[model samples]
Target: MASRALRAVVAVSTLLAAFTPASAQEAVVNVYTFRQPDLIKPALDAFTTETGIRTEVLFVDKGLEDRIAAEGENSPADVIVTVDIARLSAAKAKGVTQALEDETVNSNIPASYRDPENHWFGLTKRARVFYAYNARVPEKVMSYAALSDPRWKGRLCSRSGQHEHNLALFSAAILHWGEQRTEEWLRGIKANLSAAPSGMERDQVKAIAEGRCDLAIGNADQVGFMQTNARSPEQQEWAKAIHIVFPLFENGATHVNIAGAALARYAPHRDNAVKLIQFLSSPRGQQIMAEQNFEYPVEPRLKASTVVQSFGPLTADALLMDEIENTRQLASEIVGRIGYDNGPER
Candidate 1:
């Protein structure tokens, strides 16, 4: 009787283990993202619901590439998300990311918005637009070349030129106008700063509101933040002071930058990582990105947030992102050469 009772106990234990949820076993994907947690949480929650694969996010504000490289083969990271082509290129250049060859990813993302070798894929696009005080600069149209016009001397504000946001714009300048012309343009812009180019995008708008400068350089999403009371009542007041001007390249299209993601080279959960990337590039994912993040979606079929749509139509620069990536180092060199962040020369 004792032996029969022991056998029954063993059978029940084995059955219970077999029926345990797969999610409870080993279903997880780790993400190392430079993107803010709030911006990506909703999409991640949806992914979990659809796939039963839980996501773990580590929001690394800086040194993401260095950390991933240090982990080497033992890294627990399954994917990396970042803003700007510079960081994505840095990840690839540092050997922390691998190429992805998925049909869903390839089909959903435009070639210009992704790496030629598929190392990274852009999820959203934000134009490098101008934020001009409505009362001071009422002309609705402007060009990148025109920011240097003598009439606006000492009337423009910008963030550090070396920052990824400005570097991407400077890189596009190199691609469109060649290095020499771009350098000249940078010097002209440097000469026009009302105060040392400092502060976040919102700060630039605030500067305009405070009468520090008539014009500022910032992205389209910042405009959405300024216009909507979603962030703060003060920001809405800043929005009231400025109007968005889509600055065009001499060739017609405006320079734009992106927020993107890449699969880790040593991803332990490779399939799950792939699914996450595919999901982010999908139309549904794009919609979530638009609504939650207030950025323009990569998928054309997915409408932008109502606030963004109100900014009016945009014509993105035709230069390939890879082209911009190649010019990033040169752009930094020009920033330093021109003393862009040191404020206008006395």
Candidate 2:
């Protein structure tokens, strides 16, 4: 009986010891992210390594806003991270996110890329640029208007017309060139396709390399990914055949978008979440975002990736991102109306 009592006392003592440190070191941040693990893990590791803050991350591709809204004030999520302006804005409008007053984020991100209401801040920039076969497509055809030329007929390739990147570009054309002109532009480009819409940006580039098409519409980041570490000889050959072109002023420069973050409305670790937001928007964080991820830093002083630099300077479209927030519906209608599903003519 004495031995059994002694054993019980030791178990209690061990449990108390474990609980003490956990209670004392209770500062932890839980982040919900839509970004791919490989792209954002480096920054997450760097933040934890430098700050001694414990972090837990969950990656989900969709329905984050709905989940958080359902959780109401009981949600354990501290920060919500995602790419693209539309997703970020939608989260804010849904009231599952809260505004931040972090000086670092506000001062670092340009007004053009961030929410005017301070609910979210952009971490990186991505521009809609064209990838073309250097041997076939002339670099002078950089503007969206130029794509309408008859010379480009039966010589273009791209992802689904319903994709967000293309939708943003089409909306940019509508903003600058008018609805009639935009629709005409869409029809002209559709006429030029060498194949029915594929589902990926990389495939569009591949089509260009294979001589199935002369030009492809995509973001510049994919070009960098291809040039750096080609998984195969075919990809390397494709890389060799392609050159990037930033569209012109009449398209209103390259329409740049962002990957951004907002505080969860029910953030359990409210203070830690704010700290993380500040950290991500600071110079150190921005530099890591640029150098490691090949994204344009929100901070003005940090240089773009060398691959991005090769494309030369861009004058991004001046239209507000919010203006075309409903482009998904519009794009679906436009693409369907023009019969993009049908492959090019024989």
Residue 238 error for model 2, in Å?
Answer: 2.1
lDDT of 2 by residue, 127-158 (tens): 78888898987675467787778898888887
The Cα RMSD of model 2 versus the native structure comes to 7.0
* Candidate 2: regions farther than 4 A off: 1-25, 230-233, 326-328, 343-346
Looking at model 1, residue 51 earns an lDDT score of 92
Best by TM-score: 1
lDDT of 1 at 32: 89
lDDT of 1 by residue, 1-346 (tens): 9999999989965643443324424787888899899889998999999999889888889899998898688677788999988999999999999999999999999899999999999999888999989888997788999988888898999999989889999999999889999999988888888878888999999999999899989998877766766749898998899988999998888898889899999887888899999998998887887677678787666688787888878888878899998999999999998788899878
What does the lDDT come to for candidate 2?
0.76
Residue 164 displacement in candidate 2 (angstroms): 1.1
Give me the candidate number with maximum lDDT. 1
